[model samples]
Target: MSLFNGTIQALEHSLGYSSAKNRAISSNLANLDTPNYKAKDVTFKNYLAHEFSRPIQAKTTNSRHIGFQGDTQPAGYKTIINQASSYQHNGNNVDVDKEMADLAENQIYYQALVDRISGKFGSLQTALKGGR
Candidate 1:
């Protein structure tokens, strides 16, 4: 009876993660020249692992609710800052090459998720249309 089931919910969350990564990458790139601006990023492996390990389903009764609540999302996003290493003389840590790579990778990830969701909807449409 639910419109967004587990797989669909997972895809939605994946898209969210990809978007957050994109924003983080942009922020890092934007501060590339700022002195002492440490680069920040949302890690994928750990975040996905944590997301899959939890089985709780969070519900939002109001539009004012912010971010995923309870154990379902476990902080929703964990932004990691690069502090162990610095490559610039001004104490900034933004790695342009890595950020570019991450941006491209995140774009691909977002595209893949969108493709999957589209496929799911296509199947649903076919079913609704009484296709054999």
Candidate 2:
């Protein structure tokens, strides 16, 4: 038996993705004035796909029961350079407004994940404490 289940692993993967996205957004803001610096973004398609691909474990008493089908492959993030028109004449595509919005969204996502992990650990702690 594993100490941690797939859910914990999935949450860790999501946290990593969020951290990467935050870094990408911070880089874009840092290069807001750099000529020809295209703004980069971490795509969510692969992350969502990975999350949905995890198999749901179920118990069955019959041998003919249909089992859940899913991919066990690990999650990954894709960083893409934005091809949008430059907001300035310096050929830089970093939009402060968009980047700020994205940053706020990512921060919220990160905090939510943290809260989820904390809750999981809290449950475990409670169990270990004999429900006191």
Best by TM-score: 2
Model 1, C-alpha of 120: deviation from truth (Å): 0.6
The predictions' CA RMSDs to the true structure, in order, are: 7.8, 2.4
| Highest lDDT scorer | 2
The digit string of per-residue lDDT tens for model 2 on 16-124 reads: 8899999999999999999999999998798687767677766566889987665466758889997877888999989999999999999999999999999999999
* Alpha-carbon lDDT of model 2: 0.87
Off by over 4 Å in 2: 53-56, 60-70
Clashing pairs in 1: none
Candidate lDDT (C-alpha), each? 0.82, 0.87
Model 1, residue 5: what's the lDDT? 62
Question: Model 1 over residues 77-127: C-alpha lDDT tens digits?
Answer: 667888887889999988899989999989998999999999999988989
